[model samples]
Target: MESAQRHLRMALDAARMMIWDSELSNGKVIDSTVKWFAAGTSLLGLPPGDLSQPFSTFLQIVCPEDRDHLLDTMQEAVDKRTGYEVEYRVQWPDCSRHWLAAKAHVFCDEHGVPVGTLGIVWDITERKENEQATARERELAAVTLRSIGEGVITTNAAGVTDYLNHVAEQLTGWTLEQARGLHISTTLKLIDDTGAPIPEHAALQCLRLKQAIGASSHNQLVTRDGRHVAVEESAAPIWSDRGELLGAVVVFRDVSHERKLSKQLSWNASHDTLTGLINRREFEVQIADALHSAKQDNHVHALLYMDLDQFKIVNDTCGHSAGDLLLQLLAKMLQTQMRDSDILARLGGDELGVLLPHCPPDQALLIADQLRQSIKNFRFVWDDHTFELGVSIGLVEINHLSKSMTELLIAADQACYLAKERGRNRVHLYQDSDLRLARRQGEMLWVSRLNEAFEHQYFRLYAQPIVGLCGHGGGHDEVLIRIQPAKGELILPGAFIPAAERYDMMTAIDRWVIRAVCRHVQSVRDSLGPQQAYVAQRQPAPAQYSVNLSGSSLSDEGLRDYIIEQFVEHDVAPEQICFEITETAVIANLIKAQDFMAGLKALGCRFSLDDFGSGLSSFAYLKALPVDYLKIDGVFIRDIANNAINRAMVKAINEVGHVMGISTVAEYVEDEPTLAVVRELGLDYAQGYAVGTLRPLSVSD
Candidate 1:
């Protein structure tokens, strides 16, 4: 018996447990013997002092909260005559709690009544502490995922849905219970921009690549309810502490509003805001494509450039509000005449362009005539006025023979202008043998010659004196530009002005004229310095040099600053300068013209509205311009001696100018009869050969 006990004690010592034996009576431990191992001593912080002690002494060290459970487990084991294992907390000598597991078997007699029990106990505190810490970390991660704004979904290594946050549930329209265990692609379906299902899902790609992945802006998420929502998505692989592939997490947000705004911006870039049609930039792109097709495929196409002939009359008569309505109505009417294969665009104000693909020149001419007739027959009514309209159409064939997009447009524009020149309503066709188009080509060549003149100082400045019709001495002279080539006759403004304006070269020419005029005025000022004392007593008024500005110069914001610089450089008085602008030029860009005129007028410079009695609403628009002189158009003055209508118009213009506190000047006064009529009309000034012929502008003049 002693050998058996010694072997059993050695076995218990090897396991680091303590062995205990108890004699039970009525479910109570009457006596017990205890054997302590290394584990037991470390747990209780005590050495084994006695081999025998009452079992009640050990119960005193048990945790008060667990003592009942331990006693009940022991009683059940004794009654059932079976083995029992129970884990309970124990108090050490320092009053610190530690976990203990007891395992034992109940010994019974033949009647199945328990008499004695044997058990083993060990310390399990480290395992219990680790389990509690792991539970806390998992709870924190779940709460964090739920609190975030972005939708988050997790999948397992097999790409099956494992978890989803509240935002994910809302976005996918699927509850966690319904999504769990399903393939991630089934729950988070994606479609491309074309609405084609994407086979490779972001989560699946992340799992396959074992790295992060992202979706493009064109990607969309399909919800459970069959709604497609634009969403920005990114996915990253979840990994274990040892770098093992565990799952993937996908985060996403709805980007529908952002994507919609982007689409709107793109549309606005290519379309005109007022007309809701493709703008000039987009029209040029289509024309370029047509050119490519003609060059590469030997295809034939046609382009029609149309300009409304009477649009300005309506606009100037009524206002821009009426003009805008007329344009919108005309656009709709023109669209009905176009085929599905035809492209129409608003090239600019009162100008529309048409592209007819696979159309020959003959068919293009017919279409152009039809459009012209439709416009000519249309009538526009605004407020209390009803007026007829007209259009000039230019047709140009596009084929492999076409030179370039720019040349094609220029040819079409030239033909359109030729149509207007030939008559008010007509269609002009551009061909290689067309004489008018040939003339246009000659004019285009002038663009280069004009540039050469600027470089080589081949330009000459002339002026004509504007004297008062009452015989008062006049010192104001209108400056005119002429191109004097090295070997040819002087080229008049009529020869190059139209071409310069067409090619947007007028602003540069205007600058040159302004600088030259300033320099001329300064030279005259220097030469007249000695004579100024005598002239100051006689002609107290300053001799103003009038320079004509083109319509294009009005929109040149830097022109104002540049003019200031030139005036300062030349040291010329602003009172000696007068800017003459035509009525059509000012009316074309009224706001810009007003601002330009106001800026210079503040500096003591004067403005003259040249060709004033031309527009249909001259009297109405006259009040809007700030000017010192109103130059009656030569059309009215050329026949004023005999034509009663011309005399009446001139009389009205002079009367209006006098009433507005602005001076009136008569243009094209070539003979004594015209001058006598101009003086009889009580006009302010007369500028023509009758008053003073054109002469070279020099300091000696």
Candidate 2:
């Protein structure tokens, strides 16, 4: 029994815990494994004491802050004869403080009744301090996320949203209280532009790839309210100290406004400001593509170069306001005149260009004339000052031969120059012939002489008698114009006409001829006393004069008013007058021609389609033209008696003309056989020398 007591004491001394025995009856310490004296006292503080004392309470060593609760719990355990555990601060006699975990239970004497309390204590201050520091770090991290300006979302290892900072809540249109514990995709919906959820948006890719990743520019974010915002996204995985994947974080920002500005700038760079049309630079870009297509597809396209005539008059007469209004109105008119497939642009001041993709030269010429005439008839009633304008058009076929943009431009410029020269308001086909080449190169020399002739009135008129092959009506005389130089013989119209037309002097020339014809005819009528009138009536119908009009005059919207003004000025009767227009001119300005013919025909005047069957598209314009005569083109009629094709073509044209109720005239009849053939074709009139010799008109014509 003594050895067992000794062994119990030794075991208590060797324990890591401080062992204590207290009397439950008085709440005083009876024994301790270590002596409570001097420097050996632990856990509870003691100032000084004996190894074995009657009264040395452990309460004195317990910190005052924790003493009451620790004592109460120990007493309760003693009363219930049960075990208890507690942690409390220990204030030692050396003025040091520490934490202790205490465990106690009531012990029974040999009679099995509670007599004392036994307990164990451990110092746990280091562990407690470490736990407090870890808690502070967590709180600091949460505050940092909340304070940051950029949005942040954190998900758990299972890809569930566990936390959201203040900024993240606003960006995602959600709150931490609402988003917590939901799947990341549900709380922070990321999508593509099409509104489909992005696979990378789940942020699991970051974990799988073990690196940061980003969304494409097309990525978007759908907010909780269901509004979609354009966004740039980036994501990275959270990690543990051991380099294990813990969760993920996503970051994003909106970019809708940025995109809009970019697109607006692009549009401004390519569009015109005044007319809202595509500017010249972009038009040339489209032209390059068109030219490339023409070459690669083995097809043809046409370019229309237009110059508005008399536009400056409106600008000079009225303020620039009227001119601007004219341009705006004409731009609208020209746009309406083209097909939907065609492209139109204001090339610059008073100039417009059209791109007719896949359109042949024939149709292009028709379109140009249509635009010309449409404007001619358009009456500008601007604030009590009505104005009319004309358009001169140049056409060129875009083909493999058009090697460069500069070449195409040069061709278009040349053609437009010719159109203006021949008479404004006509479509001049661009032909690379020797004659045209010479006209372009020889322009400077001709311009001065033509001007000098106009100034000096060095121009003369001739007449060709139209023999009535049908023998039922007296046909009129076709009047011709010639230029008489001061130093040389009379000049054929062909020599100076091309230059005159190119220089935009045709309107003046045509006006001069009309005035002269009226005066000369009036003189003849006055010369014929009543007896001479009977002699003049012996041929057939009255001698109404057939006069030629330049294409430029046709496009002059004021030409009709000007013509009426001239007739009043010259005392010429409208019934005794007929106007001749070539096939190219009529077709080039179809609408203008149609309106012009309609206007004049209403006044009992007559119109004739000159040089018919010269173009492949003569039949197309014949139905639209209100004409009284179809002068078969000199080419088909020149030698029809010898050429089978020419005879066949003339026969066909004559048939069509008769069907249309138009009389046909055969021109360039150099020999009798051609005249015989013309008569056999049931021709109404023949104007060639074979029918009658060309004569200078005298008082008796």
Candidate 3:
């Protein structure tokens, strides 16, 4: 143990001496008096024997791969008398080889004869393996950097391009050699969405702050050919292992396709496919923005809700393909006439809305008039048949009085309704009372309630029998709608129907009544069959039960189809159904309504002109409507005995119906005298209290 300690101390002292001496040669220390390797002197795992033999045996213990080189290094050291260092593999006692570095210096006599050698052997196996592993990692890193799919670039602290991968070189049209060491701003240019240059120093600032920037920074890069390419890129500070900031690494991908797809999606979402106009949703957005701008700037904006008058006639007569073409042409015409700042949008169906920013009520009316004239002058050609078209416009202006976009639209819609009421193919401005009344009436709420009423079966049908006047027992019955008021007594059609028409709820109500009457006919088929058969010989087979249809419903493409489906489903003949459309509807959409009536008539269904003399009473429209009955207006009949004009009008209607082989029915014959007058006038039927009031005929009884 004492000897081992002494040897260990000697090894330590020798290592210290080698470390301190820079010029010591292999034999220089051998000739010195100080002992180098004593007999049986070994530190760590080295074997001790004859001192020189032990040292020589150490070199021979090197692995076969390194033995020759180690021997050559020893010979070189002895000949030159210089210090030597070499790393070689040595086999241990267990036959496992480990690497060692031997650094030695030789000490020599005056004639340069070798005396002794001093050396230190270090176990550098771990470090050597680590160096080989590091070399492998560097090679793998270079391959990965070049093989990356996305463009990659690295910059130094000065925002200069230090390295660029192959992809980066291809993206920028610059080779790695050309781009390296160039300022990043000069080699790789970035711009924003607007094609404005993005501050090149921004990335450097982020690196200096050791922060990360993601793709949202709008970094669009320009290629060498000046073609802009969309880029989604992220950058982060490149930091050393010890947390020292180096520069930045930016990785990016070309997003040109994605950008184009995004733009297409946006356009599709905001514009109508058929008309290439703004859609309802986009229209609302524009209106909201207009309202906001108006409020901020105290400017005026006009809203016009224009409905094509009798456009359904064109569609019904010419088919939807022609109708679509007409609409497209009308949109083009409107676009040609309107200012670029004004927005026109199809609000579905035959309705169109326009937003005119910075326009007042007077200017809005003028513009609306121009649109109306354009429509009136426009001739639509459907399969070589040319027809004139027109529009009824409702105009309203935004001011402090306007509350919301919806309210403004409603007001404009009411004004448009008034224009149609006054006679179509005209334009009217919204009155203050229109908005006030709409607000007070809560018309929209009523429309919603009407929908609920139909859903909940809250409506009832009341039949008024059109009794034969000349003691003839059989006559038809007209089904009238009776709406149950929310708070009070039941309301008749006269009281609520106008409101229904104003709000466009009449169409839905008309549908419900048609379905209801079909159901009723099915329910009472057995009881009413004989009576219907008796009346059929005198009138027409399949004795008609008149159900009034609104103008809106007549215009519905699905209406005729729906009614036909219901009739087929219920196994009811079409001849048993009589659709009563008012003279107003017939004249307003004469061509379309006539075609629709003709189509129904082709299916064996019958039609009647209800309230016959109420409208303009155009003989042309009456001749065109394909009607089987003419129900004289109640106003004329109520004053038939007192007013000569009313009597003459009723007589004229009766004469025309007779001449046309159409039955004439007089309505509102409240007294015996009025009924007697209607009978004397040769009217086919009379519907009033005096003409045998309605009775609830029960099937069981």
Of candidates 2 and 1, the better by lDDT: 1
TM-scores, in order shown? 0.47, 0.40, 0.46
Candidate ranking under TM-score, highest first, comes to 1, 3, 2
Top candidate by lDDT = 1
Superposition error at 230 for model 2 (Å): 4.2
* lDDT tens per residue, model 3, 85-149: 88788777667777777787876778777655566655677877677556544543554475489
lDDT of 2 by residue, 1-701 (tens): 99996786566556546655455454322332223333224545544344433323555666787777876777677667788898888777678988888677778778666677666666788877676545444643764464477677777767788777777788889999999999888887888877776766646777678788865467777899988877776677776533556677776667778756776777777766667677778878878988999888877898888888888888888878888878777778778878988988878888888899998888888887888899789877677888877888888889877887667767887888888878787888888762367456677577888888878877878888877886847678899988788889988988888878888989988887877887786787677899887775564334389999988889988888877876787566687789999988988888899999999988778898898876678476677778899888999988789899999998998898889898888889878898888888888898877877767865222
Q: Ten consecutive residues with minimal summed lDDT in candidate 3?
A: 16-25
What lDDT tens digits, residue by residue, belong to model 1 across residues 101-185?
A: 8899998778776778887887888877666545434643764465499888888789999888888899999999999999998
User: Candidate 3, which segments miss by more than 4 Å at Cα?
Assistant: 1-148, 200-202, 435-701
Instruction: Tell me how many residue pairs clash in candidate 1.
Output: 0
Q: Mark the regions of model 1 whose C-alpha exceeds 4 Å error after superposition.
A: 1-147, 433-701
Q: In model 1, which range of ten residues has the least summed lDDT?
A: 30-39
